[model samples]
Target: MSETIAPALLAPATSCGVFIIATPDRLAALQQLVAASGARLLGAVTPGNAAARLADQISLDLLLFDASSLAAGEAADVAIALAGSMAGRDCRIVTLLDVASIDAVAGPMFDAGATLLCNPSPTELAAALAGALAPGGTRLHDAAREREAERLRLLNEEVARLAEVLSQLAADPANGVRDRSSGYRGEPLAEPDPDPRAVRSTIRARRLRDQHFAPELFADPAWDMLLDLYAARLEGRRVSVSSLCIAAAVPPTTALRWIGTMHDAGLFGREPDPTDKRRAHITLTDRAAAAMRGYFRAAERAGLVPA
Candidate 1:
């Protein structure tokens, strides 16, 4: 890899410094990435070097681990050790793994308390750095939140437009309107309920069917995963990490990455199973649950569903 830093990542880092612990193969790339982000590179951690020594000695804002260079177990051990050494500090851990190893490494890394990126491009690398450096590690920036809000706004508008068209079609009986006299007429349909529970049930059913038909077709599993958690929360139910992956309607590796992202974004929380150290359950954070409720309220007020 080249030693040169990308111009796009050249923006100066915040006051908190960034560091990397990579094998020799990944050192140059990680160095360039850190330099491009305008953060100080303390040094690289090699096999012979003590990861604990460096972690304890330095004041770091972020630690980037090269998972491709290390086995999943090794990476998790290093991450967990570093996390322990840096306990009470604001340092965040980010691991970089190849696309193929993502599934095997993601859960272990997160269980060890680290965020991750899978075969990230330069742009993604920069964005990940920005997010890690941001306050609370819950968001990238105001601009990102604005973009998300805009997307939701657009979706609502589209739904409203489609609803209006359907209403028009219903009112205009000339468009394939069936005669009641031709068959046994059923009772008039009830008004659509705006209750979020109803919507959640419908979405859950659709997700189940999608899982059966084409699980990998979902373009944004993270958002869908959040919706699933929100629905589960509303129904007083708990979902395991494995179950959430199934709900995501994607491969386990892809779903794992999304779960990690959502957890980092402070939208999800994890609770270890008391009897099983290897198992954990994931749930929505209070903030995320509140946001979901607000969204449902807005949708109802917009007449997207019945009040």
Candidate 2:
């Protein structure tokens, strides 16, 4: 029912290798899908057998795990095993799950360093396979992990520097203090009045342009979601996860994954609704808000946007 499919590269090529790990009932359909993509089967195996094959140093360009047929802890275990075995390789792991089980399986799949595709149609499956088998497709996980690691390293350094500054300020109140109650350097700092309506209007215009010209040009939904949340915060409105997903304009599964990643990166926070335990509100974290403000300020200075 979900229209979101695995993103594909423009040119189609033969798949080098594909391995499917699933129960017997799921294997036939998966095999047909893989075969249709012109990929080498490499033999479909049960989860246990798949683990053995991975241990035997069998190389795979794409690994598909049927999460619907997996037991409670099986998918995670398999993912971890695959990740460990395929370390430093450009293998892409994909987990297939039913729509109803997406929320439940998503965490484990991601933790295992696998992409989640919820109930993809045959067309979607073929596209995903082709993309995974494409040249350089295997580097997707490695690139993402490296980026995240570098970001964390920088954030940690910044936190330490800020802590030292705070400690010094606490120790000596007037050491680096400046009197700015009236003015700085004898000139009053004028606060720029920003029109919230204009900001919203700019975002809406950009969204329209993107939708009309190149809706799929930007694959990363984090920035889009961040902009939406920033605008909503300015309007004194709260965003629910479902609403944010719609704002992402991607598949719900993909959008949800981005949300989780953003939350992990300290760019978003989740607050529970007092009236309903089942629903949670999403808001930009202080750091994310500061980052967005800095981005807007830079854009304004560049004359890309009206100040």
Candidate 3:
């Protein structure tokens, strides 16, 4: 990687968010889409309310909405109105119609400037998001970027936790994060393990279990490189949500929404950014690292990260 090309891991941080609106059948899948892809759920709105309603509440990306079993005019009307509204802010409006309803609205929908998505899935959502964001410049979400982001996220969440205990011990000599860095070899770190007692504890480190992330696990799906971006800068004390978003290859608004989710999950606790009056920073809470550990173990086991 060229120095000018700052890999996703070293990219600047930024924030971003996304919205989904669909009927009952697609709701769960959409939520799952948000989780797997790192996008935010502004809220789920009904088809009736998609046009003249809830437009003010969320900025939707790929609005995979329903038009099945409705009059062609009605479906196109709603899509047109929403597309107009979405265009006001340059937001992308994507319409998802069943195969049966495609003919009714396909032409008009596309003519109205709506990107059409059919039978969407996690892959489709991720693809659509990547295409729309095209975030490669600072933080790419290509396979390599995704894996790196997830790995760095896990590393950050894990190391901070382990390091905190070390920091406390370094300050007082009693606590630690069960130092397993040593067992994981060829690591850029570990030989510099200053705390012997803590370092020893990790040699036979046990795998962390029940590694499920709380709701925040899905924060800012659009900023797929967030973890890498944030982790890359922790040493410099730049943990602000806005900075992290930029690093993570996300827009500011998107980053804030994800930060809120992490805050709710306790991965991020409330700590206003000192340098920026209008923005706030995210400090990895103690459990936050533990939450990320499970992912690290899984990624390493799967050969996704450097085991």
Q: TM-scores for all candidates? A: 0.53, 0.51, 0.36
Question: Worst lDDT window (10 residues) for model 2?
Answer: 1-10
Cα shift from native, residue 166, model 1 (Å) = 30
Give lDDT: candidate 3, residue 257: 38
TM-score, structure 2 vs. true: 0.51
List residue ranges in candidate 1 displaced over 4 A. Answer: 1-6, 13-16, 47-50, 98-115, 130-142, 145-223, 226-269, 273-307
Predicted model with the maximum lDDT: 2
The residue-by-residue lDDT of candidate 3 on 151-208, one tens digit each, is 4476456656655644443444233345554575342321121222322222212112
Off by over 4 Å in 2: 1-15, 111-113, 137-250, 256-286, 292-307
At residue 276, what lDDT does model 2 achieve? 48
Give me the overall lDDT of model 1.
Answer: 0.63
lDDT of 2 by residue, 127-193 (tens): 5566566677442244544664575557545544544543444344434565646644553332232
TM-score of 3: 0.36
State in Å the error of residue 27, model 3.
1.1
Model 3 segments more than 4 A misplaced: 1-14, 58-62, 66-73, 120-122, 133-307
Better of 1 and 3 by lDDT: 1
